[model samples]
Target: MPAFPNSCFQISVLLLGLAAGPGLLGCARVVSATTSAAAADCLVYVGTNVASEQENTIYLYRLQAATGTLTRLDAQPGGAAPTYLTMDAARRHLYAVSETQTFRGAASGGVSAFAVDKKTGHLTLLNQQPSGGGAPCYISLDRSEKNVLVANYVGGNVSLLPVQADGRLAPAASVHQHEGRGPHPNQTSPHAHCILPDPSNQFAFAVDLGTDNVYGYRLNAKEHQLAPAAAPAFTAAPGAGPRHLTFHPDGRYAYLINELNSTITALQYQDRQYEKGPAAFTELQTVSMLPAGFTGPNSCADVHVSPDGRFVYGSNRGHNSLAVFAINPGDGRLTLVQHVSTQGQTPRNFALDPSGQLLLVANQNSNNIFTYRVDQGTGKLTPTGHSVEVPSPMFLQVVSDFTR
Candidate 1:
């Protein structure tokens, strides 16, 4: 860690709004001490999409850990419609999906790689590869972080790319096309929404909005492949349109957010014989994401579990709110806790800081981002009174407890 200058210390104080508080008593030492100890700053990355290609960018913001105040740091031009992002476990590199229908004259989207600057928290483009599909919507690293997985909406396929040692990317090593459709008009064709590796890293799952199914894959990390598991597809309710799936910290249960029906289903995960036997998911309970009598058009976008595994959070686009649910430890059932407004429109994506103390939301239609304080005991959220104007903010990813 490097020593922060007096000016840097002063700016940090201003950003944190602690000019005359007990926390500032050590301001003099902040200039000479390590940056992390002095400011407790974290880095937040915002991905945006606009009509103009030049306006698509990945913006970096610094989060004051104590106050949850976000200060703009820098921005870099990302390729077309960089809507989703993920960082490696080492925090040395980041990957984003260019959500476009065509890349380099081919009928496929692109996955871009960037190196993370430790000191400035800036990103520099390393290389890009075809996502092996069109209109890629989500990108995530496998548990090993040695491979990148992508879900393409228009192409209805999932792709795997090998991560090079230098943080660059290689072309797709494998691509699996989904086959099916649903009852909804939006589900006329298969749409792969997101692919996430299980905590164990031995298995991965992809949720399809069009097919209303969650497909399982056996991760072949050494060979850089995603082989379909013995039981490949877990069917959801007709017209449910399952979009995103998140596993609990204990890995015994998984939650599926259905985009079309505005409901979340809790499922018990049973990996019988590891890689040899098929992974099974038995639906436990299904609950509505919207409040009673609020029968308006709404869609589900994202779902995440609390770091402590005590709560589940899901986003509703038309409802413009976050639905919080408490998890029953014994049976892995969900009980509705609260429905809090995101303070803006179209809550497309939200992320909890690494410390699990702050929740940041990106309101796409309103073009703003809002922060809320998390209550560890109650698993509820309260507005932090900190908001920033970001043009068409689509997704937010926080690198909590960041030094730079």
Candidate 2:
């Protein structure tokens, strides 16, 4: 990716002038300028904690690209405590998971779908379906957009829900119950925390914090089922508590962020052998996310690789900071760059905008979302001094559209 130039403000001013000058500019030129500006803006959706007395809601906000300022848009009622949010590939539908054990008398959590209004950034409820488990914490769409995968922490399972023709969710097609335990007290049962599809779209991996394993599966799209891969799972350290996994853009490496141990493990991925054999991942290195001399309790929340694949970032909840690492392009190894404070209590989640120019961190306990400017060349984060107040912001999803 090209380095982020310093002339973004100047370019924005020029575009504004062209958009405002109808008499001097041609009609086509004015329309083009206006469309460009609209494309630069984005819509941010936040998932919040749900309380019994409080109605669960998914808050929407408008993000001004030029300044990284956020304006409250709307709060749409949703199922009980939507803790995680995801969007379809076309950006036409938004999905969120209600992280409760029971939903409307059923002994399962709920997943709801909504139609996204591109122009207003509003959401219209499409339909809701049972997630086939309790305390669903993460959701992801398959590459084909035909199925939604969910991981249930308390239920100790992973499930697949079919996506209907109209973008609504169909009843769950399959649920895989996990069994076993790890070394820690919280690891007494299988607690699947995240499920993400491999870049090849042929397989998906479920990160189980309780079992300390990342289970691989073959996505049977036709039946909307998940079958265990030949090599079913990769074992992390006995008490590492693998919470999330991210693959390198080049498809040569994979990273797992351990929530309990506060460390990241890099693995070498082999794609070619997957055709005739099971997918293979070999451990390369493990690095701590916390800074030296930090003895306080800390757990990791999220991890992401930069768009350019040159940097990796992981959120440290108790430490309240983001650990930055530089990736070795040739070897896929990581070296710690720096650890920057998140300026909040618990950064449960953070998202890098589509432009790769700004990052928004959702500090759950602090009830705020903080924005930071991404230094493209150095992979460093500088606070934008722009933040918005939200109640228990657990996750953030940003979408951009030029047609708006």
Candidate 3:
């Protein structure tokens, strides 16, 4: 692939159930916030929470995709605590969950859609619907982009919404209720954190942070419904506290990150489905996020696989670092490679550029986005000296043709 040009053009479509596959196109430098918005050829959006604001705000930024500079685009108040966000496959729409608050004239949490105006880098609010749970902290669009799914942290449930022809969101077609208890004291109840559709989109998997189990949902696209998979949830270690999981591009492997134990578990997803016990979920390996001899309050926030499927990375809150690992493609195992400091506190989330040549780290507590160049050969990250300053930045995702 050739180097990205001076001006980057990214456009993201906002809708439901859309899937941006594990593999990505190449990416250039993003626009720096210090520069003029006119210098940017692509738009970037960040979700944040700050007091004295109307819920959580979505800030629009234009990135000089080639130069890596960011220009602030028009921003608007999205909803209450829009902590996590995902964009549709077409790069034409975006979806965000209201982390907490009343919606539709009640105490229900909310999820909403916005149509992306590529030319002006502005968002047109489309529609909003209750998340069926309170404080939705994570959201994902399925491969079809037809269903918008949300996981509520405090509400302990998951909701699925349908995407309309006009890019609007309809009320949830199906919702799942999680119930369980783990080892820890606070873990005595379900704290549904995230739901990810399997690569096949035939099923969905959700992790309950408090119970340390990943729940499986059978996808019924025809009727827009989700039924519990035969073995609804798979249990992790006593207190590992499963937080999130990402599947390998080949769909043969799954990697899960735990929040409490601050460790990651690598698994070999059953090569074949089962009519017996439970789809044969087995654990292959485990590794901790922190280096030995380090003691602190454990809070592992996010995790992801390198576009090539050869590497995985996870973020640690108290440790404030990214734990990198080299994945063994043959056996679906992982070898710890490196742990890089994020250069800020509480790296709420991190994103790899479309090309997998760069990394953008969002430190929510420090209000900064640090960009790092990824070494294709070694899968290591190097500081690019390019960064953006935003207020309480929480999540990052790439969009191409954003100027449309």
- Name the top lDDT candidate: 1
RMSD of each: 9.8, 8.8, 8.5
Rank all candidate structures by their lDDT, best first, as comma-separated numbers: 1, 2, 3
Tens digits of per-residue lDDT for model 1, 70-129 = 889898898888989988755689899999989999999999999988667688999999
> What do the candidate models score in CA lDDT, each in turn?
0.81, 0.79, 0.73
Q: Return the TM-score for each candidate structure.
A: 0.89, 0.89, 0.87
Candidate 1: pairs in clash: none
In the range 1-404, model 3's lDDT, one tens digit per residue, is 12111211111111121212334323233433333311213345788877567666888765554645566767787777777788876767788887765677776788889887756657778888899987898898776778887888878888889888778898888877787788887687889988877766666778898888887776655667787755644678998888888777677778888988899988877634422335425789988889888887868988888766788889999899988889887898888788888999998788765545557788988989887766666677777777888889987755543443
What TM-score would you give candidate 2 relative to the actual structure? 0.89
List candidate 3 segments past 4 Å from native.
Answer: 1-43, 63-68, 274-277
lDDT of 2 by residue, 187-287 (tens): 99999999987776667789999998888777766789887754445789999999988887777888889999999999887555554444357788999
Which residue pairs collide, candidate 2? none
In candidate 1 the C-alpha lDDT for residue 38 amounts to: 36
